[model samples]
Target: MADRVGEQLGNYRLVRLLGQGGFAEVYLGEHIYLGTAAAIKVLYAKLASDDFEHFRKEARTIARLVHPHIVRVLDYGIEGTTPFLVVDYAPNGTLRTRHPKGVPVPLPTVVSYVTQIAEALQYAHDQKVIHRDVKPENVLFGRRNEVLLSDFGIALVAMTSNYRSTQGMQDMAGTIAYMAPEQIQAQAETASDQYSLAVVTYELLSGARPFQGAFTEVAVKHTLVPPPSLREKLPMISADVEAVEMKALAKDPKQRFVDVQTFAAALEEASRNASSRTTFLGDIPVSQEQGASFSPETIVLSQQEAQEVSPTALFTTPDVAQQPSTDELLADKPATAAMITPAFEQKEAVEAVEAVNTPVLKEKETTALTSQPPHKGISRRAVLVGLAGAAIVGVVGGGIALLTHPLGSQTAIQPGNVPPGTNGGTLYTFRGHSGWVWSVGWSPNGARIASGSGDATAQVWDATSGGHLIVYSGHSDSVYGVAWSPDRKRVASGGFDKTVQIWDATFGDHYYTYHGHSGWVWAVAWSPGGKHVASAGQDTTVQVWDSANGRHANTYRGHSGFVHAVAWSPDGKRIASASSDGTVQVWDAVTGVRLYTYEPYFTDIWSVAWSPDGKRIASASDDKTVQVWDALDGSHLYIYTGHTDFVYAVAWSPDGKYIASAGDDKTVQVWSAIDGTLVYTYRGHTAGVRSVGWAPDGKRITSGSWDETVQVWKME
Candidate 1:
């Protein structure tokens, strides 16, 4: 490649070559007309014709996206088939250069940096562009260590058009260290960018990549092994920060952050209260001698080892090169360290002198703030107030019992009732059911409870009163899943009948039956708008159906094995389904076209659910854990643990504040969704607890177990 510096092209004058690589060369350039400095990247002339079209498409896509943390794309053109892109020239170098080597930064700084990058990536995702590559090398640092994401050269347009390539490798384009499992498996999409961002953030805070080795080793680790938790290395790191990082690295894209903004917000909050102090990542030990040995082979310090290097030439920068001021150079010296006591004693005397010279106010305006009364359902003595009501019910026909606990003071509570976090609750046994209860859910208003049992029956109950509502017995085989519509007006159930039964919420009257899947329908969910329903099954398919009628809207087929769970994004535009083949697929809810496939775990994916904002997805798996991914680029966010057995189900609260997971371990764990912190763990069932659900108000949670009883617990 030849340098184009000093050559005029499209009102810009190239100044000097910045870097060169096989595919492209970047140059420091200036706009002859605007007189502004810019960075211009031009494709290699040899491969111009073949990759030019793709380059132009990507440039156009980026030029339309405007974000403060992203490198601004100002212009693009082709000069005799040599395609080029003009982007902003950041004064600070890449983040890779600015980072302190062999040292982990404070948690707050890491969060601040990653948050800024995530915000920029979120902006690009909202514009339907995926920054295929996200690594420290591509991020630039600005004043006060502000971060900026650069180089969208491999970005893919996410529009619903025929603009994408059929080439398999293009789908896998990204830095290897940061690529999500889906991208490594050649199924990359917008969500892949999210996974990459999580990897970058993990490295940013921990000072080491989660998985790095030979190409095959790293790939296998990402697919089969669990990532070490951030808290495990930095014991002092806050629980919230750990949760956010873990959520971002979820193996299932649907289970991860839906977009960059939500992930960034969570990271920001976590960083503000962070307190980690570990010096090294993983199990590595940090010794005093570690900083002394800077080998030339391992470290990349360019100017130092060169024999011709000069000290005066090295200190050429005007701002930092000058001799330090007398105050700065002498402030922290040993001599000044002994003068601290005198200065401290003089401080109060100086303040007293100033106070004597200042005048006192003659008149003052005073106002007092009055304490407001406690909320309607909240007790004045309660330490925690829930967002809504808690009710319990016992059902006869379904062999179920609901227990209601009001959200108030514990002083008036029943003798047998236990306060939140106590192991003093009763273990009531329902002996009527002879088979497993495959699925169970609480109504939005927390008034009714529903269950689908392997006995081929779907039953409803009054949650607060502990009375049986009705049993809708029509499916020929075992009923597997049940869900209440968002409006609480209808109920939908799927079973081995290969059909979905929709019933009137108040009664057991069957209203509509949707017949489509070739195998057992394992799970179903209502869209946020309540206009459509999504179902997945052993048929390796996902079907969207009309909520008003039994009409099939679309059928999605991509999973290689049984499809176990399905969930709708909060916006109703996307749906995610997890399969036994160890992949989670994101699809267009209306068209059923597979948009992205996440292949992280080596075993089966058991459940999938979307956050309330529709920006993230969470998936539980046979791997005995849950992973959160970026919903936009399929990036891994974080991995969650605590279950000793395979995770069976996962659900997000209506506020997207909490996550509840139940598994074969016979326990249910509630986590802080914002940061993946374990808040409460309920262990009562003698057998496996297969399903869990939260009330609409997010105050309480319920679980169905194979021990033949449904246990309801209040979440404080």
Candidate 2:
């Protein structure tokens, strides 16, 4: 095999031998014309001569089993009596190489790989082909971490010639440890493949094989002994998952799972349930009492209320007769120890009270409220008098204010009182970036806005006052994306320096720099729980890393072109990445397994944002459109074609009713997220708008532009 390293077999030039077994040698081969790499498995000359028909049959069987999870047989031929089969090359090596000794892989990752392999086996079984040899060594990974089931050399085709007898008793096919009880009796079937897969799954979860010994001993155990419980080896393995594995490893073929898909689905469900129980819920510590009282039904109802009410309803003034006194409202809402302060400076306390009392609208109630003529009876002075009275009462009551104040009292500046910078509803224009402001994001509390710039810095500014608060100046190159951690104490920024930097939100102190990306980092998004940050880059990969210590967690590499933007689902379980490959892919954040790819656009997709509820994703592309689609299945829900040029940014409103997008059109357009109807357009920036973000209050949007300004405004 070593001497034939440079030998030419048909159109393939063998680079080196990848591996070798008793019957065949696997070589790394390159196509002479296309320079594409392939794994060429060549049968030993002696074996080829004795089983030429069987070797050809193996090739035909693999060629017919075409699926994404199954390795494709590209070409096959006999060269001087040595038959060879060419299959897709997997650069990442095999599952055995990735997990050599039973090292416990992450639960999500174990389930993901098992489900993929099972699906592939189900497809092969549907074609009446039983992979007689099913083990981790035969499961290969492509460069993008795509799982491919390879080595169909020992597969059995229904009604085909029996080759097991020709090999004789000396060379019983399949790895002894993974063989099913029936397979040991030379009665291999689809169920036999299921049993072998169960062994692989068990090994992946617990990092140990079910039964281990010498070849003869292991074979005897497979035929006569029941497999050990996975939980016994790894107590963390849930009982449900162990049952799934044990059921698939049933001694009798008929007692095993009817199909590989059923077993895979069961394992996946168990994994998800376990993950949900252990998922991080963020920095907000919940006491046992609070956690016990948390009702998912109440949360759902709140979300529904938010989604149904117009954004205006949030600010609608109650009838004077229905209005509760400020003292009564404050008395009903007791301040927690976290919210109470001993020394209350009136000026600072007023600001704190206003911040604390500001209502963060529910996700469902984000739509623009029905436009109604203002009440002509109540004078503006009377409204101001009411707010002033509330402020005085708040001071007397130690900084406790009514939570639901009229919209007039909430926003200091009214909608029609447009500020300078050529806009109708502009509240403030922040001018500090020396170059283009590439991205803008609002803190969870809507208190601060962060913007990344070509100036090689990210600046955090007060959202309402437009006052510069902190300047993060560490990146050596232009900063592209900025995100606020869910706790609002940390900020994450990605830049042209091929790095992601986490810094203190208030003091501008650098926390850590993540340098895992090989290409310029384009976007950074904090997970909803604030524990991890997902970053996209020109390297065609999306990486999730620990926000605390900058530890690289996982890398997702399915995109063929540069990944421009990444966003986390609200639940923090899934991530969505938009790429120059013209696709938006939603993947598991923990497992790095791709879930869905949305490719409605034919040109580059520049940005992606998940809906507040995580049900949909909105993508902005160079195709001059912003598209909203189902996040789980990639079904196109709506397309906003109002932009005339490349749309660079897309953001879903915190309330979930609207989407704001900006691009080369030099304008920021707000459209109904539900039906893609045009809500309003802000044409304030002189240069193209690069990024836009929704204020946490759900009342305003802030847009950063190449014009070197960040404009905060509201839709009237």
Q: Find the candidate with the highest TM-score and give its number.
A: 2
For model 1, what is the C-alpha lDDT against the true structure? 0.62
Please give the CA lDDT of all the candidate structures.
0.62, 0.67
Candidate 2: which stretches are off by over 4 Å? 1-422
- Candidate 1 lDDT over 1-716, as tens digits, reads 57677897677899999876323578888999779998887754322355656656766777877778878889887788666778888778887777643445666667678778878877877777667678777888655556788776424321211221111111121245576655444345666777777777777666666654322234433542335555555566555666566556654455456566677776776555443423323323332111211111111111222223221111111222233443443344342212223332222122211111112111110000000111122121111111000111111111111122333322231111112354333223333243456788888788888888755788888776547777888887667899999898999999877789999888888997888876568898888778888888866788888889978888888876668899887778888889877789998887778898899976678889888787788999856688888898788888888676568889898888888888765678888887788887787765567788887777767787655567667654
Query: Residues 151-173, candidate 2, lDDT per residue (tens digit)?
Result: 67434321222221211211232
Best by lDDT: 2
Model 1: CA > 4 A from native: 1-422, 425-434
TM-scores, all models, native as reference: 0.42, 0.43
